[model samples]
Target: MSSTKDIDALIEMMAKLPGLGPRSARRAVLHMIKKRALLMIPLSDTLQNVAATARECLNCGNIGTSDVCDICTSHKRANGEICVVEDVADLWAMERSGVFKGRYHVLGGTLSALDAVGPEELRIPKLMTRIADEHITEVILALNATIDGQTTAHYIAGELETRGVAVTSLAQGVPIGGELDYLDDGTISAALKARKAL
Candidate 1:
């Protein structure tokens, strides 16, 4: 067997990770080899543990080591509000924002007619069930600003219309303290369309 075979295999595997290319993976593997005790060993052990235990939350589709995520299991987070997001990353982003106090529903992806993704493919049914089972009073659509995102929001809004749940969208337009000079035309138009009475 070649002495570098296993190391080459490791580099190949690392290259498949989200942000790493072959060149970067080689550098990362070399760095790990240099820091074997501090980073490599611990990282390998953690990766194995997560690979064995990490799972999608059954209730809300969040990624965790348990059937239900910590947010779903926490009594303090049972605030009767559910913020729907397109992906787990979006949910994490909202959490980092620290402005949303309620729980979340991580739809795996947006509804896509081209991809033939329907409500069952996502978590629409589970969301409706959660609304009834958890006594959800409001559903805040936190989808992205893309067409698929808005389409998904409108679909969810229609589903919740007669259920007595208040549906709201994320406010559109420029970001906090964003300069108009740096804004695009579409953003400016949306801001004007969403203008408030104040």
Candidate 2:
């Protein structure tokens, strides 16, 4: 039994992390202690470095270790198109797919009436500003297929309707590997409605 108040405090803080509880935090702390040379020291140094340097890009809301993110500053990504996503996770997912070759605008979150989240709360104003500033020609709504997501998309479309920009959305359907038997009624209906010639 170590009398290290600092270690206990660290465990408490780690326990507060998303998806990590007290038990997992304790186990992780113990494992980190055991692998101090291999993991703990490096992790501490990296966390400190990131804490000191991590910042949101001024142009976009993407998190990076600089004033501007790599994507925003890259000339190759200036394709006159902007893909709009709700969160950074969605941006990362689009990046992982390697399908899009344009700039991105993160909305922070969807417009939620229940939660009282509005356009101002997100980066909507910034997005609108970026449209003219970046000389964007098209705005792709890559939001999730939820009710709030569609509402937000429609609101954005309406805003951009007169801005001389083409607005489009991802095709709605069952997922690539989704089984028809396992799909919900809404999924089935959407897939049927969005069906095209194969």
Candidate 3:
């Protein structure tokens, strides 16, 4: 009986997206419906096209419309360094920062003992192979600050110990523009420990 059942279903589906809640999804759905010709149709077409063609890159584990993503195929990015990340989302975040010029290796997910995830489950084996095949000189770990993320980073560092490649991790400390009063004890300690000459 609800005449708006299909619209309700659409709102529910949109709510399942990362940051949108039910209220936001409803607003979005209504807005799209109001702008059906201007916004909804183009978005629907693009979504359909992307859903049909999106594929993970075989070389770097990045999602694209091809087997190998543009980053992996770009010669300018072959800087003998590979930034290792936990997921495609992490890889995308790093790319958006525009700081790292080298290629990347997405592990798919961090090693989780509780979840029964291991190196085999991730792309660790592929990473090791890439080190040798691509003549990689350095590997920068950009995992999250969570317990599982740190555990996975340590494990990867151990694995790369004998691989003749320099292994480093992203700096962990106070964030830029963060106030000292609002900072955690661990963060303050890390910032002090990593203090520079300036």
Model 1 misplaced regions, further than 4 Å = 1-3, 196-198
RMSD of each: 2.0, 1.6, 1.3
Descending-lDDT candidate ranking: 1, 2, 3
For model 2, which pairs clash? none
For all predicted structures, in order, the TM-scores are: 0.93, 0.93, 0.96
lDDT of 3 at 1: 28
lDDT string, candidate 1, 64-173, tens digits: 99999999999888899999999999999999999998999999999999999999999999999999999899999999999999999999999888999999988988
Write down the lDDT of every candidate, Cα atoms only: 0.94, 0.94, 0.93
TM-score quality measure for candidate 1: 0.93
User: Lowest-scoring 10 consecutive residues by lDDT in candidate 2?
Assistant: 1-10
lDDT for 184 (candidate 2): 93
Give the number of the best model, judged by lDDT: 1
Location of the lowest summed lDDT over 10 successive residues in candidate 1 = 1-10
Q: How accurate is candidate 1 locally (lDDT)?
A: 0.94
